[model samples]
Target: MAIIPRLSTPQTSPDTGPARNNRRGMMWLAADLCFNIWALSIAKSLGVDLPPIQIVLVRALVGLAVLIPFVVWRGGMVRLANPKLQILRTMLSTIAMTGNFFAVAKLPFALFTTVNFTRPLLMMALAALILGERIRAKQWIAGGIGLIGVVIAVDPGSLGATSASGIGALFASVIAGTSAVIILRRMRNEDALTQMIWQTAGLSLTSVLPAIYFWQAPGDHWPILLSIGVLSQTAQFCFMRAHYWAEAGVIAPLGYFSLILSVTVGYFVFDEVPSIGLYLGAVLIIGAALMASHKGKRG
Candidate 1:
């Protein structure tokens, strides 16, 4: 999952020093990852019947609705900076989210989640390309390893309809999501809540018309629909708090748990028994991500 930009807060408060906060941060990050996966999994389950656009619309609307009161409570949208960049980032985020919903519906849960692990590699490359950051040899090697893992899991030789189109959507979503994160890193001075409001509002607006055109009255699934928004936004809150409380390296290992969660959920909840290739590929992907993150921290 993409890490939400850090909220504006002091690095260390008198009430909680670095050690205590680091522990708290890791816990929050773990919760955030769990909620995020659960939200996506719920969307995937719903996607079996509902239109992907409609699901995206509901998620975005619920997210926006939840943010409105918070925005009002903290005084109106007065903290925004770099409006153009914000719009650009929001547009990428919208594309990323819509594509993610589409992929979740089409791909196996395990495959989809594993493919997402490549986002860090993509982000690292984007940093080098867009931000003109130097790419060390080890990082490049990690990216190569991640790509190989993806190929192993995808098994391009057996490209059926399942792997072909969903793979495209999955990668597109990951790239767009990585781009949004790159932009977020650029907007470090911008208020985190303001960025979130813009994102939710943008997603809602972009998806509304399509949703209306393809409108299906969520019927009995309204509760599930509502939960997507609630869970996702809560997860985003945890993500922001996690960053505020600790360095990325301190919380990085917890991210590997997502794969275990994905595999378990895929098997039990979705009855997806991935082949041995998937397990092998996942190991390589996770190892590469860990190496990249570690090198990133050191750099």
Candidate 2:
């Protein structure tokens, strides 16, 4: 249970200039990305034999339990705001989390992460449709290139690659992208803790029954599951705090380093060797995400 270190709490200073904020963001981003990637790999290993829903539900409950004490200490229920949006964002994000875990259990890590490259592209489209944001030509071009990468990596025509979990993860990424817009909107009114608390509570509530029905005894897997919960909670906090302290441009590029971590873990832990197509696709996707971020700034 003590396998993971406690994350340092981030403090925001109004007077901290861009240089300081950028450094802080990079540090937080690096820490959170590592924590999240590590947690996901562990979750996949432990949850492989167990029901995916059961594993995720336990993670949710553990996270909520962890947060309750902190939330109470930080003004309790009064900290929660914009109640309807919280529920909406929570459900959407949980759907994405559940889908990612479910997919991770079944798919190879490189392929799984490659398919996720579509998320930023999808977010652009979703923002245009949902948030009424306008898209630029560069975003469109980059997104098209990114889509090609995903198609190459996922290879929907392949019998083994396009399993139910693969398709499910693809669909979930789209939903997750859309949910992010709502979360961004809500961030203006809600603090990160409130959102984290509600998200855990919602995931636990929604997943409990399904988890129970599909439940297989985790047995010796409890410690890994607990660490998953702890790391994920910490990761979410770092993720939110990263954005809060710095601009999107500073944060976006640093995030792509996660690909390296995921690839390394996949090769060593699951013996998943990346194909040439997987590498190419990862390049396209990461490039597209970076371009999209730059495009947003230009607009």
Candidate 3:
């Protein structure tokens, strides 16, 4: 296990140190955004016919196959130590990944993305309660604003009007957010490669049963599945790099970019336009993300 550094305020250092790091961080952030768009595009192309678990299993297996070579090139099987913690992390990640994929498959892309934005707000509360990190008044305020945004986006009155699938997507966001906090905590003692390997492997193993039970042969779906696996792995790798160059607080907010990407893709590809409430909610969520990013910079 490696000790992950705590998030720190950006400080002046000699010779453009902070600036260079920020640039690198932003580059990785951009890469992550692109990767996410690709992943979503693949999901959209696949449509909802294939079982979510089956899709996840295929992606996980392919991701494992892709990553294994890299892991081996890095240092072979020895790169993975601390099997107990690895297993725990993998299980937590599996839940998050499974839930997220299911949501994507079953829900509208824009709505699904909006709900996913709740992760940062949840992270703030989790940090205070579980990590013993101080939560400032501003952050609490931001969290409230973000929650309001989520409500606006979901528009509870429309829950029944809309598909129950949307509600499931929202719930998946909660699970994913909590899982993220756990991953952050564990990251303090784990290498990024080790974390990725175990998480993907866990996803592969856990999804096996569902994939079998609901096994729909790949057919024309092979390409999309492979794309999802590759894109997801790349996005995660870029995210890890971003965090390494910067801090979680700094990089996390950039995740909001996914919403913009998703909305664009949804409109152009599926001819689905977001409602006013959705835009309003998106604004609030983006505001919260900005505030959080600023706080991270100043912390």
Cα lDDT of model 3 by residue, 1-299, tens digit = 11123245456678766533767787888898888778877876776667777877877887778777766676864455567666666666656666666666666678888887777678778778767889888988888898899889878777663357646755865766486565557566766656666667777888798689988888877887888877877787777667667766656666778888888888888787889999999899878857764644543
- In candidate 1 the C-alpha lDDT for residue 83 amounts to 79
Q: Give the runs in model 1 whose Cα sits over 4 Å from its true position.
A: 1-20, 296-299
**Per-residue lDDT for 1-299 in model 2, tens only?**
11122355445457863333778877888998888888889877864587767767877887877777876676775546577777777667667777778788777777776777677778888777777888989888988999888777666666364466556774675667467565657467665555666767888887888788888877888887788888887787687667756787777878778788888999999998888888887888888878887743333
Q: Write one digit per residue (lDDT tens) for candidate 1, span 64-125.
A: 77777777777886647787888888778877887888898888888888899898899999
- The better-scoring model by lDDT among 1 and 3 is 1
In order of appearance, the predictions have TM-scores of: 0.90, 0.86, 0.82
CA RMSD of all predictions: 3.3, 3.7, 4.9
Total backbone collisions for each predicted model? 0, 0, 2
* lDDT ranking from best candidate downward: 1, 2, 3
Point out where model 3 deviates above 4 Å. 1-21, 79-82, 244-253, 296-299
Positional deviation of 41 in candidate 1, in angstroms? 1.9
1 versus 2: better lDDT goes to? 1
